[model samples]
Target: MAIRNVLQLGDPGLRVVSEPVADPGAPEIAALLTDLQDTLTHWRTTTTYGRGIAAPQIGVPLRVIFLHLEQPWPLINPTIIAHSEEQMVVWDACLSFLCIFCQVWRYQQVDVRYQDLQGAWHTVHAEGDLAELLQHEIDHLDGILALDRMTDIRTMCTREEFEKRYRERSPYAR
Candidate 1:
């Protein structure tokens, strides 16, 4: 598999809701997973940071997501099982919009149900940064982006500006 080009924010494909993968064991699905990992790895190599990617981000309208949270894994037809009542705000960035960052409010925790590469169902409990990242990627499957999660347009800023003015104090600060 090769690194597929990531669709940009303005791309019509990015706005399309992904369809669920009917056959998780399909060969095409495997290739798509590889392509996703390759793309994510390539991006991380260049930027030094990347956590997750949804199928739609690569112009694939399939309910699939690749996550690299200490361990890399593919999530198929992922659904949020439950979320905490509490919410937190974070400066969110996206590969689709590398030029900007937006302040977004997200659930503090989440329980997600998803399928493994073998097509077996599984669930994961995530909190803090992991919770935020999963929510972001799942939103992509529904044709949602971080900008849409922002309460005010004024809170959005150029990546450079975010770095200069808020990076050190940002919740996502390294």
Candidate 2:
């Protein structure tokens, strides 16, 4: 398993809706999950951004998502099984979109149906930050960016400005 370059926003791969993993028990699927973990680790260590990644971002058009919450969780072919009427809006950024951030509406509490790494079906309910991040990553599988779902996109910044302001890169903006 190797970490792959995340496709940028303009790439056709980013727009292609991913296909679900045919066999959750397949070896390649497991490897893809590993790579997704790598992608998550890259972002978590290299930036103060996110803790999850979707397959499309890493050049794989599979309906797969790697969640790095308390432990590494692989959500293969996940589907939103249930959603609450309660809505919440949170500032979100996509790895493929780089420095751009947007606010999106998501169910405050969501029950998702997904298969685990061991090919067992699992249902989990998430709220707050993890819920928001999970929903954002799942959107990637559907070829939807946070920008597209953003209600009011007022706060905007280029990669250079964001990096400088967040001390992510060269702190020359000061």
Candidate 3:
């Protein structure tokens, strides 16, 4: 269980649709979760931004997501159960594309069902940034990147540009 190299943008492995995690308690699943935690921690420590990561981002094509919000945890075989009609656009980034951010529209609210490492099932209702984060990570399971979700191609910009133009200068600052 070590920090694994994150698959960069354009890696073919990043496009593979992740398979459902059949056994949440499998040793491989545990190892993958550990790798995700280590990798996400390393990224956040260095960049000050990563909050969540998906298994596929680390070359493990399994439906798993590691989140470091108020608490750190893993969601195994996550699926969106419901979404609100209202949508909002926000700047989204990815571990695969560490240098850029894209404006993407996502549902304002979502209900997700997922399993724990112990194989127990649970559901979570998320909204705002947490909802957006869940949707972003779930999209990775289907081979979708934040770039692919952009409503306007022109909205994509380098992280440095994003910081200069919008980080604290605009109302869109996240």
lDDT scores in order = 0.90, 0.78, 0.90
TM-scores of the models, in the order given: 0.94, 0.87, 0.94
Candidate 3 regions exceeding 4 Å error are 169-174
Candidate 2, 102-122: lDDT as tens digits: 557888988888987677888
- What is the C-alpha lDDT profile of model 3 across 1-174, one tens digit per residue? 698899999899988999999999999898889889999999988877788999999888999999988789899999999999999998888889979888999999999999998999999999988999999999999999988889899998998998887777432243
> How much does candidate 3 score in TM-score?
0.94
Model 3's alpha-carbon lDDT is 0.90
Between which residue pairs do clashes occur in model 1?
none
List where candidate 2 sits over 4 angstroms from the true fold: 158-174
Clashing pairs in 3: none
lDDT tens digits, residue span 20-88, model 1? 999999999999999999999999889855788999999999999998766897999999999999999
Residue 53 miss distance in model 2 (angstroms): 0.5
Show model 1 residue runs off by greater than 4 Å: 169-174
Which of the predicted structures, 2 or 3, would earn the higher TM-score when compared with the native?
3
